[model samples]
Target: MAATVVQLTESKKQIQHTHQVFDTQKQAFRNNPMPSLLERKENLNRLKRALLANKDRLVDAIDRDFTCRSKDESLIAEIMPSIQGINYTLKHLSGWMKPSKRHVSILFQPASNKVSYQPKGVVGVIVPWNYPLYLAVGPLVASLAAGNRTMIKMSEFTPHTSALFKEIIDSIFAEDLVSVITGEADVAADFSERPFDHLLFTGSTSVGKLVMSAAARNLTPVTLELGGKSPAIISPDVPMADAAERIAFGKAFNAGQTCVAPDYVLCPTDRIQAFVDDFRARFTEMYPGLKDNNDYTAIINERQYERLQSYLEDALAKGAELIELNTANENMKDSTRKLPLTLVLNTTPDMKVMQDEIFGPILPVVGYNSLDEAIHYINDRARPLALYFFGYDKDQQQHVVNNTHSGGMCINDSLMHVAQDDLPFGGVGDSGMGHYHGKEGFLTFSHHRAIFAKQKFNSGKLVYAPYGKAVHKLVYKLFIR
Candidate 1:
C-alpha cells in the first residue's frame, strides 16, 4: 500500500515538472515567434559541435548501457549519421527557408501567392532506448533546423546514456530553447499528454498508438517511426553468396536491434540450404567470436536476452529447425547475455517468432515458390518500415517497387538507404507514418503557411454579397469551369 502511494506521488511530481518546463518553452516561443535563418543555423551548428565533442563520451555511455556495445557500431550508426544529417540540413536549409512562389489564377490576377515555412512552437521528442543518442538527435536536428523549441523525453531503459545526454543538452542549451527529461513509463505518459505543437515518437507500434492517443487531446501533429517485421527478399536470380552477405550485415549490426533491420528473409525453397550456409559463413567472417568479444555486442539486458531465448525455445518446440551461427562454437548457456545469430527454418505463422518482432539476432527464413507468392506473403502482413530486394533485373525491380507497400524500399541493398542524405526516411502503414531526415524532416517540423497578397484596388467588390447580380453571374460563367 505504501509503495502504491509513493508511485502515485512520483507520477504527480513528474507530471508537474513536464507541465512547468512546457510552459516556460511556450512563453519563450511566443516572445520570438519566428527565428531568423542565421539563428537557426547557429543552433544546428551548436548541436553538431556538442555531439562531436562528446563522441567518445557517447560511445562509452552507450557501452555501459548495452554492456558490450561495439565501439565501431556506435560510431558508424549513431555519431556518423547524426553529423551527416546535421550537415545535410545545413547545406539545404537556406533554400528551404525561402518563400516558395505559386502562380495566381487569372480570376485572381492582381494577387500573388507564396508559401512561407514557419516553425511550430515547442516540439516534443520521445526517444526510445535502442540507439538513444541517434534517435534523440535525429529529431532534434529537424526541430532545431526548423527553428522550434524542443523538449526531449529520454527512455528510462537506457539510464546511463540518458543521464549523459541530459548533462550534454543542459550544458549546451537553455531551458527555454531545449531541455531533456529522464523518467519511467509514468513520466512518458505524462510527457505525451502535454500540449506540444508537434510530437515525434520512435519505438514499437503499440506504444506509438498510446502516444498518439495522448497527443490527440491537443490535436498535436505527430511523426511516428515505429517498427514491424521488415523483410529481405532473395530473388531467384541473385547468388546465395551475394544475397546472404548483405542480409548478414544488416541483421548482425547492433545485434539486429535497429528499427529498419531485416527481420526475416524469404528465399527460394530449392536454395534455402545455400542461403543458410552462406549467411552463417558471412556472419562468422564479420565476428570471429560471439561471447565476451567486443566485436560482438551483447543483448541490452537480461530481460531482453531471456525474451530472445524464449523465442528460440518456442521456435524449437513448434518444430522449426534452428541453425546457431556462433562461429566460436562456445557454450552459450552462460550468463553473459550474448546470443548467437540463429536462423530458424520452417517458421510457421503460429510460431511466436513469426508472430512478434524479433528485435534480436534471430532470422526466420521462409520459402516461396514464385515472385507472386513472395509478394503475396509480404502484402498479407502489416506494412513494414523497410523492404529489401537482392536483384539486378530492372523490370522485376520495378514490379516489386510498384506492387509492394512499405515505408521505404531498398534495391540490391539492406539498411544503407536510410543513411542517404537526399532520401526521406519513414514508414508507410502499420510499420510507421511520417518521415524525418533531410528536407522532409525540416518540413515535418515546420508549417508551410500559404499567404496571398492583393493590390489596393478591391477586385472582390464586383462579387460582393447580394442577391444575384450580372457581374457575379458573368464572372462565375467565365471562371467557374
Candidate 2:
C-alpha cells in the first residue's frame, strides 16, 4: 500500500513538471514571437552537433532499450536520419522564411499582398518507441526551424533511450526553449491535454485518435504520423530477384518496426513461390543467423514479442502457411526476444495478420491474378502511408500511380522514399493525415498569415457606403462578371 502511494506521488510530480515546462515554453514563445533566420540556423546547427557528439551514446541507449537492437541499425535508422533532417532544414530555412509575394488582383489597385509564415508557438511532439531519436528530432527540427518552442514526450516503452535523450536535450537547451518529457502512459495523457499551439504524434492509429481528441479541447492543430498496413506490389514483369531483394531490406530493417515498412506484398500468382524463395535467400544473406547475431535485431520487448507470436499462431490456425527464415536454425526460444523473419503465405482478408498493421518482421504475401486485381485490392483497403510498386514498364508504373491513393510511393524500391529529404512524408485516410519533412515540415508548424498593404489609394472605400454611386457601379460592372 505504501509503495502504491509512493508511485502515485511520483506520478503527480511528473505531471506537475510537464505542466510547468509547457507554461514556460508558452511564455518564452510569446517573448520571442519571431526568431531571426540566423537564430533558427544556429539552433539547427546546435542540434546537429549535439547528435553527432553523442551518436555512440544514443546508439548504445537504444540498444539497451530494445535488448538486442543492432548498433548499425540504430545508427542508420535513427541517428543518421535525425542529423540529416536537421541539416536539410538548415539548408532550406532562409528560402522558406522569406515572405511569399502573392498576386495583387488588378481590381485592388495600389495594394501589395504577400504571406508571412509565422511560427505556431509551443509545439508538442509525442515520439514513438520504434525509432525514438529520429521521430523526436524530425519534428523538433521542423518546429525549431519554424521558430516554435517545443516540448517532446518520449515513449516509456524505450525507457533507457528516453531518459538519455532527455538528459541530452536538457544539457543543450533551456527548458523554455526546448524540453523533453519522459513518463508512463498516464503522464503522456496529461501531456497531450496541455494547450500546445500545434501537436505532432508518431504512433498507432488508435492512440492518434486519442491524441487528436485531447488536442481538440484546445483547438490545437495536429499532424498525426500514424501507421497502417503499407503494401508493396510486385509487377508481373519485374524480376523476382530485384523485387524480393528490395522488399526484404524494407521488411528486415529495424526488424520491420518502421511505420513505412512493407507490411505485406502483392505478387503475381505465378511467381509467388519464386518471390518467396528469393526473399528468403536475400534475408538470410543479410543476417545469416538470428540468435546471438550482432547484425540481427530482436523484437523490442516481451509484450511485443508475444504479440507477433500470437499473430503467427492465429495465422497458422486459420490455415495460412508460415515459413520461418531462420537460416542457422538456432533455437531462439530460450534466447533474447529475436524473431526470425517469418512469411505468411495464402493469406485471407479475415486473418489477423492481414487485418492489422504488422509492425514486426512478419511479411504476408498475397497473390494477385493481374495488375488490376492488385490495384483493386489496395484500393479496397484504407490508404496506406506508403505503397511500393516494382516494375520497369513505364505504362504499368504510370497506371499504378494514377489508380492508387497513398501518402508516398516508390517505384522499383521500398523504404528509400522516406530517406529523401526533398519529399514530404505523411499518410492518407486511416493511415494518417498532415505532412512534415522539408518545406512541408516548416509549413506544418507555421501559420501563413496573409498581409495586405495599401500605400496611398483606398480602392475598397469606393464601394464602401453608397449603394448606387458611379464608381461603385463601375467596380461592380468590372468584377461581377
Candidate 3:
C-alpha cells in the first residue's frame, strides 16, 4: 500500500479575480435583470444547441478522466438530461412563474395577496469530479431557467475535463450571465467564502459540512448533494439472477464512483451464498475479460485507489472473506489503479468497508435474519442518497419505501429513480440536503416572493383607529372562524 496525499493549490491573485468576477455579475444581474419569458426560452434553446453540438467532445473528456465512461452513459446522464431539463422548464416555466393567489380578509376589502417568483441573483455552483459535466451543467441549466446568473467552480481532480468544460462554457455564454472557475480545492474554499445569493454543492459529506459552514458566514442558502452508504435490499421472493444483474450493472458502472450507487447489499441469511454466486456470474457476463475490459473503469487516481485498497485490506485483516468474481484470473496489478471486482462476506458493522462508503467495485454482502432486520439495518445508517429494492410484491415494496427515508428509491431496480422527471432527487439527513432535477431543480434555484397589494381605499381604519370593545367585537366577528 502507498501513502495517500490530497493537495489543492490556488493562488491569491486567482481568488481576487473570482471575487471580482462574481461581484460584476451580481451588479449586472441587478441592473439589466434576467431576460423575459420569450428571451429566456431562446436562451434555453441556445444552451441546448450548444450541448448537443459538443456532445462528442464532452464525452471524450469524460472518458479521458474516468478511463471507461461510455459515450452512451455521458449522453444519457449529462447531455440529454440537461437538454430535457431545459425543455421541461420551458413547457412549465410560465405556470411556475405566475404569482400564486392568496385569500384576503373581508375586513381589508380592497387588499389582495399573491406570491411572485424572483431570482436569487448570482448563484454559485460547486461541482464534483465524478460526474464532472452533469454536476456542473445540470445545475446551471436550472439556474438559467430560474433567471439567475450563475458561477460554476469545477473540481480540480479531473483537470482535463474541467479545462474542456470551462472552454465550452466560456465560448457559449458571457461572464456576467454564466462563468466557469477552475482550479483546486483552495479555490473552492475561497469561492465558498465570497458572498453569493445561493450555493449548490455536490460532493462528500465531510466536504459538504465545510461548504455549509462557509455559506453560513453570509447567511447564503445552500443545496448540497453529498454521499452515503446507499444500500440494496433483495427480497427472498425475487429471482436471484435478475436482481444480481441489475445490481452488477449499477455497482460496477464507472467502477462504482456514483454518489448514489449501492454501497452494500442486504439479503436473507439463508440465500447469502446463492446470491454471491449469482452476482459473480452476472458481473462476468456484463464485462468479459475482467483484466483488460475497456468497459471496466480504473479507479479515479492513485489516492482513491489506495483509499479503497486500505478499506479492503482493513476488512480482510478483520477476518472478512473476499470472493472475487474472477478468482481464477491473475490480478491486474500492473494497470493504473485497477481494483478487482470483488465482494466481502461475513461483514460486520465495525468493518471499515461497512462503516464508510465503498466508492469502488467492492461490495459488502451483509446477511439479515428477517426483513425487519434488513429494514432496521438500513434505518440505522445515515439516510442514503438512494435505496434499491428487488421485489415483485407491491405491499413489500411500499413497506420498504414508507419505512425508510432516502434521497430516492427504485423498485425492482437500481439507480433508475433518477430517470423520472417528476420525482424530486436529493438526500435526507447526513446524506445530502435539498432536491434537484426537473421541476425540483427549478424550485431549488428559485425564490418565491410573497406580495401584498392594496387599493387606494384604507378600509382597515376601523382597527387602526382604536382598540376598544366595539372594534374588538368587529374584529372577532370578521376574523374569527
Task: Write the candidate numbers in order of decreasing TM-score.
Answer: 2, 1, 3
Model 3, C-alpha of 79: deviation from truth (Å): 2.3
- What C-alpha lDDT do the candidate models reach, one value each? 0.91, 0.92, 0.84
For candidate 3, list the clashing residue pairs, or say none: none
Best by lDDT: 2
Off by over 4 Å in 2: 1-3
Error of 1 at 457 (Å): 1.5
List candidate 3 stretches off by more than 4 Å.
1-10, 327-330
After the best TM-score superposition of candidate 3, give how far the Cα of residue 198 lies from its true spot, in angstroms: 0.4
Q: Return the lDDT, model 2, position 436.
A: 96
Q: Which of candidates 1 and 2 is the stronger one according to TM-score?
A: 2
lDDT by residue for model 1 (1-481), tens: 9998997887788778889999999999999999998999999999999999999999999999998899999999899999999999999999989999999887777789999999999999999988999999999999998999999999888999999999999998999999998878999988999989999999999999999999999899989999999999998888789999999999999999888899999999999999988988888889888887897888898898899999999999999999999767899788377899999999999998898889999999999999889999999999999999998888889889999999988998889998998899998888888999899999999999999999897787778889499988899899878
